[model samples]
Target: MTSTVRRAGAFAGVGSLALVAPLLGWAAAVPFAVVAGIAVLVGDGPVFELFARPGDWEEGRLHGLIGFALAATGLGLLSTVEAMPTLAFVGAVLTLVYGNLAAQVVRRRSTDPVVGAVGFVLGGAVGCWIGILATALLNGDSGVAPAFVVFLSASGALLGALLRSVLFERDDPVVVLSVGLLLWFLWELTDPGTVHDVGIALAVTVAVGYASYALDTASVSGMLSGVFLGLLTIVLGGIGWFAVIIVFFGIGGLSTKFRYEEKAQRGVAEKNEGARGSSNVFSNAAVALAAVLAYAAAPIHLPVGDGTGIAGGIFLYAFAGSISTAMSDTLSSEIGGVFDRPRLITTLKPVDPGTDGAVTWQGELAGTAGATLIALVAVALLDSVGPTGAGVILVAGVAGMTVDSLLGATVEGGRLGNQSVNFLATLSGGAVGAVLASGLGIAAVA
Candidate 1:
């Protein structure tokens, strides 16, 4: 276990270094790549032992691990032909996956797709991070390269995967912090105007966190302090995507406070009277943050229909939809509870105002209205958003709200936690928005 811990820590550091060095040549990063490959290959042995749950592993030798190391070392030679560290890292990943699969075949092991993917991303990210960092440190002077964006985005995926992994369920909070910064350091290659972005998110988070604190929205103790800072950084990094989030915070925060006493009396009020902690924020906004990052990092263009393809795509719609979905759900639950008679969405049977899956006409309307308001606000902020995009946001919001209700009626608070439900709803809304935006030009021409 001690050895496993050391390996994990060292690999995590390697990933952090890789993230910081996107500008370096793949050739220069060969050494870092070799080390990371060895770390992962060796760590697999004890790491499997340390965190392995029942039915998690199969009989295997070090052959696959050796092949992975050799492949990485060979790919490092690609620096002679291609200077890009990301490319070399990609080759290593492909080699590692193939090697692992061949090992599984030889051992007759039953592979879990989820676990396989987790292993690839988690370990691959660390390897990639180190490779890029070495390259940049050894040969950098060109000011933030495009490879940095590629690294940051990859790191985000790795960060998300690590966060959601059950390996840390029983572990200390340090588990998250350790990997999170390593992944975030991937963005160091890019010199974004973070002061403005961070300032915006911090100013809002502090004000809202403080107000919620004063209003008993949640106990200050329950609030995850780190979540606030992390969220601010995410928003700041997302650039134009921050406006919709601000809209979400302003509206969602107020709705939670509205009729707080009545909600408490009725036993339907949000826990802590909607003074959300870190988990609440993450549940409601994490998907939105991811959408915004996707948009800002790589804007997906939709064809405006005049011959140029993907000229009209606006990922902002997806970002707005996620925020809209979160707000719609919040507004309906909070505002609707105060003004309308409750009806069970599943059965149409009257229920107490706070009953799970309960809905009110007033709440439904408020939810739709909230979605519309945010859709407009988001588009206005971006100086983008067509009639079709706006309408699609509204639809996605309503759809997500319904999904939330369905989850609440069945699994929420039990098999699926409230945070999980929120994440699913937001994700659904983002997908809907992206799909709709993809066809905006077609609809416009039609």
Candidate 2:
């Protein structure tokens, strides 16, 4: 606990520096940088939690000193190379702090080299990009402006809290609120917040979530989580996208219930009848949620503006792939049990019905049909996918399903786990769709 406090303090200080880059130059950042450096350099305390070192005085002090030196060197380099040295320094310092912190924290979390490497790459990329942008913003800037400092500080703290929640500690309501507030902050940056818009989004999320629960589409816990993710989708994807999510819930929920007794007799029924829990929803929709975020971040040529144009955009393409893949997997799994015989994917030997990694011709066709159905629906409503994009979605969905089977036969339930595999399958499908769209010249470079 003591260490947690100290580590939190250090992270807070680092976050403050990063958050202030746009509003306050290094003039305002230098002191906080010093504080963060000192926090990291603390010879004893929670700082050691991150670096995966035993909290021994001798070893701790050496690591602390190294961390401090790295930070100082980063700041120095930023000041030398950037036109807006103050902002540049702050950005560079933040990049160093966040990236290194993420790498260390990830190392502590996982022994897997792949996981650690992925963490490092993502954290470093975000840090460096933010730093470079700050440097560019500093061009022609003369003095520090006090305006927006308070707001930006809060935003910074929110990000800090989020980093800790995701990477270091458990989730908190405060952190959740921080996410909402930051999202609100971003939304308000474009225009004034209207009660109508907020009310409608909330109402939609509540209605759909509650309806799902009342209708036994999900459990109570599932409803709560669904509301959260659903509301987030509204914020990120808008009403049209939210509609697609609902379609999935309604259809998938019904399918799970269909012939539930028969499936149960075969010992292939879904847990809790047809009702799903939070984990199930997340496994299916998380990648789609990420796709929505990626889409909103950049200006893309959406298929909505006109029927004939450049591709609907990477976000649209990826979202389609993700959703289609998830639906395909679901339909295939649920419908496959009706087939009397299944073949093992690896050896092509006959396997018991519903065996892990087993595939059937009937299941494959059902899965492809499901993907095509979802793709067509997206095209009709979202207006963001072309025929080519839809085809890519279908192909990727099939690929994701096949890969999921391969994984189910191997790493799943051992190293990767089922939920993790589901997320990966959707992610793989999204990636495939993205690549295919790009290769086909359907999506423009963003």
Candidate 3:
């Protein structure tokens, strides 16, 4: 069949789901998922191809369809209240259908990649907003506030646009599925008091993400992941926690640019002009993010400290340690590689500047400075961590940086990628911080 026929078929198939979604409620996800799975095994042929763009991978189409089926079904189950289920179902259905159509139009009309990206993001937001509003009018209630609607729109746009590119424009269903799941989570898990903070968190995250992209400090995927992380920090850990991550990003970017021309000539400079990708961002921040989540979920507060007391002391310390380690490793690699002669971490033998496991006195000092700065930020902004806790966090960060070098020397290329090493380093940093803080009876208050 021609592309037009395929497109029409996809539209009809997805649109048909929207029409019957009210009746199916949460049960709508299974049949389509089952069909997509069977299509994957037997080969979708025209069935999957109809949802795929030109030159798309055949295998990815199957995954994409399956993801959409799950998302569409899952969204409807977001609330158990009467009319809320149908409202969510129709809103999701129209947002996705209309958003997909808008993206197609923009792609055909504009060859500029920037234009295409903006169109896709804005189109999806507009689609979701319109869908939600229209559904609210018809259903007489959306069971959510206006701010939440905006948040949902933003979430949908970011998830769909970013994931599509991150996944290489294949497996588009993953994007759909992620967006749906995230929306459901937000709807269900958010505290009522946090409703006021939601808008600011989103605005700040988006603005910073755009700035990072414009400055050439972050790739598209990097920006997306960073924004997601930032939003979580602000929403879960509060703006103070978000500030620590921002400081790390700023410091990391500045460090990358330090002695850039010389580092480039020496062939040790970061690729793509030091614009970080998704892998780099995630690896560096994963442990810190986990710490933030744990802090948010802590049920009891310790009585020893002034603020969050024990829980705050523990998780905030871990968050600080992770961020400090990431910054330390980044600065060490970027600045240390430029100023001093390097020695292998394992044998202290002379080595090239960019050699894995290379270490230098200057690099170690730079890493220490980076760790100190992050720990200081935690001390200043977080109520739970004082001078003593900051000291422990700093120590943990330095330890993690040491671990990174040792790992790099021992098993970097053989058993672990650079990103994996970074992740382990951050994880070690957080773990060490948690241990020390708990042992010291530290208390971190919100």
Best by lDDT: 3
Across residues 110-203, which tens digit of lDDT does each residue of candidate 2 receive? Answer: 8753344344434643554454445445554333232222222223332432233234332222232343234333433322124455456657
* Number of clashes recorded per candidate: 12, 1, 9
User: In what order do the candidates fall by lDDT, top score first?
Assistant: 3, 2, 1
Relative to the true structure, candidate 3 reaches a TM of 0.82
lDDT tens digits by residue: candidate 3, 356-427? 899989999999999999888888887767898888889988999999999999999899999999999999
lDDT (CA) per prediction: 0.56, 0.61, 0.72
lDDT of 2 at 388: 77
**lDDT, candidate 1, at 249:** 68
TM-score for model 1?
A: 0.57
Q: What lDDT score goes with residue 427 in model 3? A: 93
RMSD (Cα, Å) for all candidates, in order, is 11.0, 10.3, 4.7
- Poorest 10 consecutive residues of model 3 by lDDT? 78-87
Q: How high a TM-score does candidate 2 get?
A: 0.58
Q: What is the lDDT of residue 182 in candidate 3?
A: 56
The most accurate candidate by TM-score is 3
Residue ranges of candidate 2 with Cα displaced over 4 Å: 1-194, 300-312, 444-446
